[model samples]
Target chain A: MTAPARTTSAAMLDEIRFDAAGLVPVIAQQHDSGEILMMAWMNRDAVAETLATGRVCYWSRSRAALWRKGETSSQVQRLIELRLDCDGDTLLALVDQTGVACHTGRRSCFFRAARDGDWQVIAAVETPPDELYGDR
Target chain B: MTAPARTTSAAMLDEIRFDAAGLVPVIAQQHDSGEILMMAWMNRDAVAETLATGRVCYWSRSRAALWRKGETSSQVQRLIELRLDCDGDTLLALVDQTGVACHTGRRSCFFRAARDGDWQVIAAVETPPDELYGDR
Candidate 1:
């Protein structure tokens, strides 16, 4: 007997409504701990690929590639839930994460602290990208 | 001699460019561990308050009020870092978080796992709304 066909974009598209830019907002969260990680945009293919595989996939507006979260750091995000807002233009993805989520090598891209009406640098975990990304 | 006054919106506004809606995207991250926490929207005042108090403040689109992260739950987000995108339309905030970031009671909002063309429920930390939020 042959295996069943995989779920395609056409099937999932009914529930997901993309914006005019063909992008849907994706909210990332930790799996076991249940903390929100970050939010980004994903195109149809990115969503489809994420569902097709356990890995969280995003459309990188900057690089224009299918960004599999943690592909570089091996801190892959395993999808848990994909929710749509009332407008159907946004998505909330619950995921299990492995390592630092930010490219800066920090657990997240957010790293600034606001104090005394000024945005100040407070905490950082991983080393800055001068060494990781190699000089800008 | 008097101490210097804190930076005002007039000065900070010079650096930030809000979208037509007068809302800017704010990214949240963990403080001590350096993990990406979450992303939300903020208006001009919310930005000012976050800086003034060292607490993470956001503009709630649903309620239209200034939301202090972890206000209700005591899982506060202490401001650590605030960054600006090249265009100055987006804001990145690094914060020190106290508790779970998700309404569901998880450390993060993300908890679903996607695998084999389907979204699978992997981990759940927070209790359901019926228990946590208490029936709206």
Candidate 2:
């Protein structure tokens, strides 16, 4: 879709836009160090919560509720910066994360080995569900 | 944009499809456990690499190259399962990750703390750039 023109200042809220889904693509990054953390979807409420509360909030399609990153496992993400792409359909959220981002107990959920031409399993962290989430 | 109908399966290639960018959204999960890891983008080549070598591979838009997860810091990921959403635009990769996923050295990149109405920096893992990049 060919979008309208974009402005560089926060006063250009008229130019900044979101999709029909009321959701924007958010790219999570590590603050202070400036490292990319992860990418997720956020709606207006999620955006508001993130900005107002400083915690990373995501609209969970599966749960159909607002999901605070690292809620269950005590892992938390603090917001550093909220950036909008030129089109304003995408966002970049610089955050400071805690504990593990992935449910598997690793720092991130992107832990797969790609080598030669095959997808292989390499390393893993976290205890099995039988132990960690047995009650659930 | 409303997408067309697509096939859905979990039998590797039979389950997922990619866009013109040759990339698919991969959701990572912990290996030894069934924790939802982080989500990332992977191109067909990256998928092929992961399947071929058992290592996690991702397309680095910044470096414009193929990135093997944990290639630099000895923090590797092993693929457990590859799942596809009904839309075929998304992929769920079950993996086992080693070491830290975030560059900051924490187990994850999402380490921010949210309290009251403020986002605060909390924990951070320290990693030497040389250890990860090797003077690249």
Candidate 3:
């Protein structure tokens, strides 16, 4: 979905409070089900790119560069809405996910639940990791 | 609600990967409505306490102390389920929130939506900050 008219990406960026690492934690939630899919980091450039391209982009700490979601797996996330928290330190991106959102191929990264003193795997992997990234 | 049978809190603790600051980011989501309320940091002690007591607790970065939710505002959050991401770096606490969860008195911290390139205040503050912490 298109961002409603008036505000510009630059103005939106000015409102966020990025951390010392120039990054803000972003949580991606399913637009329809409200299921939280994943949490990632985004830099100013990543946020601007997501807003500009309508595709979610994150700053990969490991790679130390821009990591577009599903770049390898093709499980792209289309931005439905981008939300900034009251404190401007965090973000919530309401998105339309194409497929699974976890590297493990689970629909969500939060597939493990604390139960009876231990974590129980509550959701099964929808696709195997090797399969998702095999061609790459 | 109580944590289910078998696994112990200790085992659960071992599964987590705290940051260099000895903190893990925790996202509190409304159990029934599936609405995301807020995001905060939780130290090992905070996690242990929340699992032990079933009441949400966070590590206040600013105050550098254990922050019990609603301790000041009485907007307590009762833990329904604690979830861990595959990376073991973040947490998702499914909670039954008593009242507003935002310090700004909004139901959620995410009250600002990106619209037409600008941040729009979509939700009104339910209770003024002064009123929520007036007694303190």
State fnat for each of the candidate structures.
0.20, 0.00, 0.95
The residue-level lDDT of candidate 3 at B132 comes to 93
Off by over 4 Å in 2: A1-40, A43-46, A49-136, B1-15, B33-37, B126-130, B134-136
Interface RMSD, prediction 3: 2.1
Could you give candidate 1's per-residue lDDT for residues B34-69 as a string of tens digits?
A: 454455789998887776677778999889898987
Query: Which digits, one per residue and each the tens of the lDDT, describe model 1 over residues A1-136?
Result: 0132244446456556676778877767575564545668899888777766757889988899888876655767877656544345556776787666766666655344334454445447665555445654
CAPRI tier of model 3? medium
Give interface RMSD for all predictions: 5.7, 12.0, 2.1
| Winner on DockQ (2 vs 3) | 3
Comparing 2 with 3 on lDDT, the higher-scoring candidate is: 3
| Candidate 2 per-residue lDDT over residues B22-126, each given as its tens digit | 777665656555433355678866765666666778887568788888767788887765544334556666678776666656554444433233333455566
Model 2 chain B: ten consecutive residues of lowest lDDT: B1-10
Which segments of candidate 1 are over 4 A away from where they belong?
A1-22, A26-40, A49-136, B1-9, B127-131
User: How high is the lDDT of residue B86 in model 1?
Assistant: 39
Choose the strongest candidate by DockQ: 3
The TM-scores, one per candidate, come to 0.59, 0.49, 0.94
Candidate 1 TM-score, true structure as reference: 0.59
**Better lDDT candidate (1, 2):** 1
